[model samples]
Target chain A: MNNNQKLERGAEDIFGNWMQASMDFWNSMTGRHGGMFDPAGALAQAAQSSSDQAEKMWRSGNKMFQLWFSILGEPENLSSFAKGAEVLPGFMTQTVQQMWESFVEVHKQLLSRSTPLGQKAPASDFTQPDLNIFRTWKQIYQKEFQKFLNVPQLGLTRVYQERMQRFVDEANLFGTALAEFVRLFYVPIEKSLDIMQTKVEEMIEAGEFPEDPKELYLQWIKVLEGHYTTLLKSPQYTQVLNNMLQNLVKFRNARNELIYDALGNIPIPTNRDMDELYQEIYQLKKKVRELSRKLEAKSN
Target chain B: MNPPKIAVDLILKKLAEDTEKVRIRAQKASEVLLSPLNTDIATTPHDVVYQEDRIKLKHYKPAEVRYSTPLLVVYALINRETMLDLQPERSVVRTFLEHGLEVYMMDWGYPSRKDRYLTIDDHVNGYMDNVVDFIRARHQLPQINLMGICMGGSFSVMYAALHPEKIRNLIATVTPTNFDTDAGLLHVWTRDMDADTLVDSYGNMPGDIMNLGFLLLNPARLMIDKYMGFFENIDSKPFVENFIRMEKWIFDSPAVPGETFRQFIKDCYHQNLLIQSKMELDGKRVDLKNITMPLLNIYAKFDHLVPPRACELLTQKVGSQDVEDVCLETGHIGIYVSSKIQQQFAPKILDWLKARDGSAKTQAAGKKASGRRKSASKAKPAARSGAPATAS
Candidate 1:
């Protein structure tokens, strides 16, 4: 068998064993097998079951990687594959691997430095925060998995399958963009809270803290408004917002296309059909109104 | 780092006082909230004089008409025109009527899916022009006073420029003619928006989405502080009633037609074609120089949506020599609802219209009528002078 096929078979075997282990655990936990359930035993069994398959998977995966790298290494083969699939993702794997390491390191630092409430902590250092899990997921998916979605389909349902795949890919991208946009929106809140906490601590130290909760809320909101005003006007926030909106519109269009295709079989009319007819009617009415206005002016 | 040192006794005393205050206020607030409250808005007496395709003209007739020329007010399509008559005392419509000026307001009703194809030309040239013509024909006058608010102000500016011969006095309130300034978040955000794609996906721009955008512009204030204020003053019947009225008006948004939104975002916000007089409607350029009518352009100095820079350039660009600009110290909605600002807003418009009523005899009659109103108010208090005595 080819290295790719062998790798896929190994993956399927590993997945099957994992699913079997999960079913066994659930069945034991529910007492369906009428045994004293041992969670540790179930986990151990699951690990034991997949351990051999993992070795086979690793060997197959190594062979597949060698095959892909060999193909990507040759200038001639690279040009041929590049023309068809945009670019083979082999080139980005090294860069993504580096980024993933540094991303993990930065998050580790952040988690280590996090302080409890009522304690003096340094100002929030979101400047180098690696909060974009979606970016990592996208990179990994692109490097190892996205090509599966690009595979050509056979038979009469080829175009339908292609559209469905596109809809799913677009949805994933849109969701990632939305998450990033929401994270950017929360920056102001985070900064405001940090500042508010610091100021409140200072006030308490100086015996000037307001006793009224309402007054504290008013102060916090004022600071929050100030932070939001600055963040919203920033170029970074604007770009993130635009990206999210563009992604949303694209996702909606993809979804609409799928819906329209499905509606073609039903008796109901699609939005496209209605929109086309509406455009024609609108144009006709506009023309008639123009002509009647001209005729009325002439009569007057 | 050391923990914060707070005085226990101070906090305990304040907490005890606050708990008692909240307990008493909570009881009164519940009683007030449960009772029948008159939170209805736009309670002015008016008739639907005309309507065409989800559009209506509300004619608020005065007790005695002092001016031969009628005033037609066009409000923004983003929200309803009920904001003008939100409350009795702060009602701009009632204030105008009490001053002996006949008013006609345009209500661009909620748009449906079929209305998605409607464009700016359809609104300014088609709907607004038709309403103005209807009013002119009814009054048998060649020209009438035209006023626009916010987006409607921009439409009015376009209408006056296109059909200046039919407009005698033009008043633009909180209008955003120049859209290039980054003074407002809307201007900065809309500049990068793919309006065409948005309209293609969503047939019409939904109102709730626009409200969310507005709330995001000042989330700390609009989303949190405003609610806190409501909770703080929940025990006061007048405050609660007024707060509910405002909440109703703020959320009563109407979806803008797709084509109109696309064109507005592209032409006004992105390209800023209106102030430069390069904006086109139905192949006709909206040359601001065509607006030769006497212009009264008024805007709030503190308006975040349409800043002064956006509204201050029209008088300089328009062809009218008798253009007057008034910048009131208020926010966008405050110009219509603030008790202190409403006094200046309605009177200024009435005086401006009276001066430009085109005939000296009408001015004399209006002055005489105003003098009589002053004496009548002195003899007896105005019935709708302030908030109702009850929790309405």
Candidate 2:
């Protein structure tokens, strides 16, 4: 237990505490019993945690350098420099990769078990129509592949390249998860909102009072709540949710003809028809009198 | 100086004077020679019935006596009435003439500032009635034909309803009846216009402002493409001449009177009252049912200014049993000027009028005859009236 050892232990303790706090923040924000977290609050927490970790890491690294300088007598040494560079790169790489992997795995598990807060699927295992799902799926897959090409081979040495390659291979698994989230979770919720808005407008125009206006309003709110829940449970669901909402709006618009036809309040045609009918009755009466005159003449 | 030099100078001066005199004489001779050609070319055979506010009614001589009825041609106030008889080859007025129909067209001249107060009622009731009466009196006919173009078309429809007995045949070309529909940008903007503010500020709505609005409706195509097209075929003299003529016609817009502008927007655009049969011009109910005369509604299919939908509703709303809607494949201006219209549409209109020539007598007999007498008398009084004779 030298000073260097004390610093290293302190760094480990700080990292552990930060990771715990980060997890706790995420749990509170997404917890069922707890009120939904404001997006601003979540963003602030993420930024604070990342900054604290970087600060602690820097302080510990400086302390370690001081301790090593005291022990070595000479400041310039190839082995010391190489060790500093080599060990930290592997350590940091492992830490970040583990964090990302754990986050993704937890997200998947949560999505699988949880239903959106205000909405349930019509039936268990019920899925949205797969009309344009393939288009989005292809786009996501291509984007993920391009992201793979962009990942830096995090190595100044040959041995590090092997480590980097392993990380890249693991990152590729997120692609399928991203695509599934977009198709299944995000799209359906968005489409439902769009449909709800359209229905409300149509109802208003048709002059049909909603059975419960509050319930109609709640339906709209439920869509937004469902979107947030899906987004929290699986971040990749945002794109699909937007697509669904657009489709729902289109569907709602298509229902206007039905609503308008049922109302039957447009004034032009009914008036014209009435006029025509009146004219026909008048003509009929005139014809009857003419026929009676002809009969009278024949009888005479 | 040499004797020949002096003689040469004197001879040259004499030659110049002689050349001047001969040139003058030649000019006079050419004027004399071309005078009859110009008169024949310019003089539309249509007779002038009534003149007021620089607007003259040209009475059309019928080819045959069928129904003692008159057809009034309400040309758009924006252009010279000569467009109805643009040329013998392509004259809408001539077609009506050949069809043995009595036609009366309004020639709206360039209105000076003083003439700006002329309202819609003044044109419809005062001028239009007078022309109708003039025609009625000339042949002792009971009713007259009413043909309106563009703005005039809308005016004619209003007039026909207000004085329904006077109109034997109602022909409206490129007429806008429904202004609420988004069939054209003009309809959409005009539908919500505050016309009172515009009319009150400007006694007569400026023609340039109207022209600018029309240009903006299809800015890229109408403003740019048309000019570009002119430059492309500038070398051909006939093409250039026709292009200049069209350009001149397009720019020659008349100031719409204040009250007329206000009523047009209120009745036709804002309220969409005309097509709805809810409009009242001069306290008289403008009911389309009142327009029970034979209506030959002509509209252009590709008219960007007035869509077919706008004009098509007139046939549906009007009470006429013999309403015939002809949708010509042309633009707004093209209804009058397009070569295809000259070849097809103009002739068809004449034929339609020809078919209904005999039917007018029966229709007018069913309706009031006094309305016809009032309009017919207007035509006769211009000739009989001893006011300063205006150009008809």
Q: How many residue pairs clash in each candidate?
A: 0, 23
lDDT of 1 by residue, B115-176 (tens): 88999999999999999999999989899999999999999999999999999889999999
lDDT of 1 by residue, A1-300 (tens): 999767655655564565456545654544432232222476656776465565456556655655565555455554454455544565477557666876675566556434332343233333324345546656655655566677898999999999998888788879888988887778768777878888888987787877777688778888888877877887777887888889899999989989999999999998889888888888888898899999999999
lDDT of 2 at B63: 65
Q: Candidate 2: what lDDT? A: 0.59
Candidate 2 structure, TM-score to reference: 0.46
Worst 10 residues of 1 chain A by lDDT: A30-39
- Return the top candidate by DockQ: 1
**Which pairs of residues collide in candidate 1?**
none
Error of 1 at A266 (Å): 2.6
Give DockQ: model 2: 0.00
